[model samples]
Target: FVNRNAFGHFGLSQDDFERGMNGFDMIAPEDRPRAIENSIRVMRGEKLGLNEYLALKRDGSTFPVIMHSTAKYLDGKPVGIRGIVIDITETKKLEAQLRQAHKMEAVGTLAGGIAHDFNNLLQAVQGYAELLLLKGREGDVGYRELQEISRAAKRGGELTRQLLMFSRKMESTLQPVDLNRVVEELRMLLERTIPKMIEIELRLTGNLHAVSADISQIEQVLMNLAVNARDAMPDGGKLTIETRNAIADEEVRRSQPELTPGNYVALAVADTGQGMDKTTLEHVFDPFFTTKEVGKGTGLGLAMVYGIVKNHRGYITCVSKPGEGTRFEIYLPAIAGTQATPPVDARETELRGGSETVLLVDDDDSVRALGAELLQMFGYSVISANDGESALQVYGETRGGIDLVILDLIMPGIGGTQCLERLLEMDPRVRVVVASGYSIGGQIERVAEIGARAFIHKPYDVDEMLMTVRGVLDQE
Candidate 1:
């Protein structure tokens, strides 16, 4: 007879118990055949060490469990069977989390490697494009062509950024953010960006708790989802953005492997469009998996959303049917007593130049050369180092003359992070502008925490590079 605890584990009450309710009744329908086959082996005096399966509870929910069964023989022949059933729901969740983390890490390593090489190539293309632009007026021959090249290179840079974000390689500056405010702000944009045929609705909860996340990345997630929703409803349909405070109880947490038991803020994007089938939904968050025709999609939207949510320590899930519309719910952990800062306007800032000495450190010779040239053009005397060792040597020799160090993050010999540590040791006041082909996520954030003055992503334009240099140098 199953004990109270065992029955409770299956969400069954003792009053409903009956001998007719065999183990098969508790086993998931899809797994019943396998469970019976294993049990028969146990009955035959075979040692079934351990077996894993999905067991169905009284509420029609399924959970993972590990069972070990052995024959209870009275004589030489086996009479019956006894077993121990251990609940492995939490274990299964942890294992799933670990597997997802490992997968992201492996993919991130590959993305970082490719981005580094691609950024080097773009640097040369963009550098020449800018140089050509300076020689000719906007309407002059090859001037517009140069501008187009620069634009294309910038687009390529964005593609790499999306890839890095999908792999969770991009470093993010996390801060407390109000979910309601994000939705409200996005609604204004959605109203103009989406087609007139598509109706937008905002269902923001009042006094919603704040979540810890990057404001820009969170906006990116919302915009991607909104664009996806618009595309889904070609004929026009209703799109809804909703937010609310949420709490995950133990029972609820078991069903969502990515979520732990805690308070959370839920943001749901729903669309009354042609929803995805199970097959499409399964691969929706996979990079480069798109249902659109060629030239219509790159399929990085959902994948980037997944990576961003994971980096924010949040959980996201999609609900859809073939035609019942679709909804994506993202739950981010919430904290009390925190207020969100309004996002700064994205208008261009006035470019400035400074007369200071700069030590440019980069593993890539092309990037270093281009960076040094650009710095000199901005009125700064520039020195170059191809590696961290040489950069440190230069820093030690011209300690007072070097106003700032623009250090590349991924270099041969000592890595950019290690170099930062050594630099801080040598001069705690060393102002470093950490630069990389990669996004300002993982490694970049680490360096920032260790006292780096600023950050700039690779393939930076003349204006961007100059402004960052001027900004860091001008910092007192």
Candidate 2:
């Protein structure tokens, strides 16, 4: 009650206090009237104890504060009011963050369920279409129609993967990646795609430490961020992408709860554009949350980026204010001693048929039959099993002849990983390719750790199946 530190804590100086700064001056403009009424009640000895208000600071910042006020009297004469104010800025921030997290988690659960079912149906559609393409003659009417169907199914598969990514269910291959190289490649692509009004500037720092991450996912993050920056600048603005090495110690980790103490590669995207207010920035990464007009955005760009970064064991932070533009900083853990692995070109490898025996196991009857038929068409003999238990029995019977196993990840009895472990125990040299329609982030890694030779996602074509089979078999 006697100290002047309360006002000083709100950024007010001694000069302002001497110049007749009052409690009303400390209240935000929109909240001043309510605060004045409450103060009047307290002065009247009504015992108005605690109230929440937006408090204004000398630096023009507003924060939530809990104000406790009571009238001080000397012998029945009211002299003044003694009050206490406690800032609730951190409390409000945590509440907002918890709400946003719960919202995103709910959205992700729904999206993942939908995408998982859709991928299964899409795989069936794509598989039958590919089989039809093999039988149909080139340039025939039916052949062209089947090609269109295959293309559309492929597009649908891509959409499902994107949804899975946003849901944090998609698997990624994390490898040492050079962010500078990724940025350079995206620069060329953005140059051709971005609007003429927006200028793309690359401030890539050389010799940046390599971060372990999925190359394609990182590319997606950069592209999505760049696209977002482009959209923020409706009239015209400069978009700059900068990279640097950063280290997060105890203090930094405390501030960014998502991060731990480690060396990190910092990738920042800054834009001089319309910018965002505090309210808008809070929900930027929420699934399907967007500011763009209808038909302009799907609102999954930043959400996908958020999922990818979190899946890669990284942290992302956004900073913005109205009329001041926006910046997003992504920090990925950096490895100590490894050269960045160059991204592999996705060009189609030659599809060659092989004369070998394969065991195909899947709980889905349609998938199993399709896989078997495709393997046979590829000039290979295939043994089929309807479930993991049957698969083990069949492998036991055909162990001497079977060269590879195409094991479905999800099965009725004895799941993929369990069946894989049993198979490895039975035959330590067993060459198996794990296949699935829906996989969590680390399913492929689990298969690899169990000695699986390769993995193919469901809905594979004849060529893709044959190529994968041959690659796995040829590996010495």
lDDT of each: 0.84, 0.85
- What are the models' TM-scores? 0.83, 0.85
Candidate 1: C-alpha lDDT: 0.84
Kindly provide the TM-score of model 1 when superposed on the true structure, using C-alpha atoms.
Answer: 0.83
Q: What is candidate 1's lDDT per residue for 382-441, written digit by digit as tens?
A: 999999999999999888788899999888899788888998999999899998877535
Candidate 2 residue lDDT tens string, 379-451: 8988898888998999898778889999988776789999999999999999999987567768888889889
lDDT assessment of candidate 2: 0.85
lDDT for residue 11 in candidate 2, whole number 0-100: 73
Screening candidate 2 with a backbone cut-off below 3 angstroms (N, C-alpha, C), the clashing residue pairs are: none
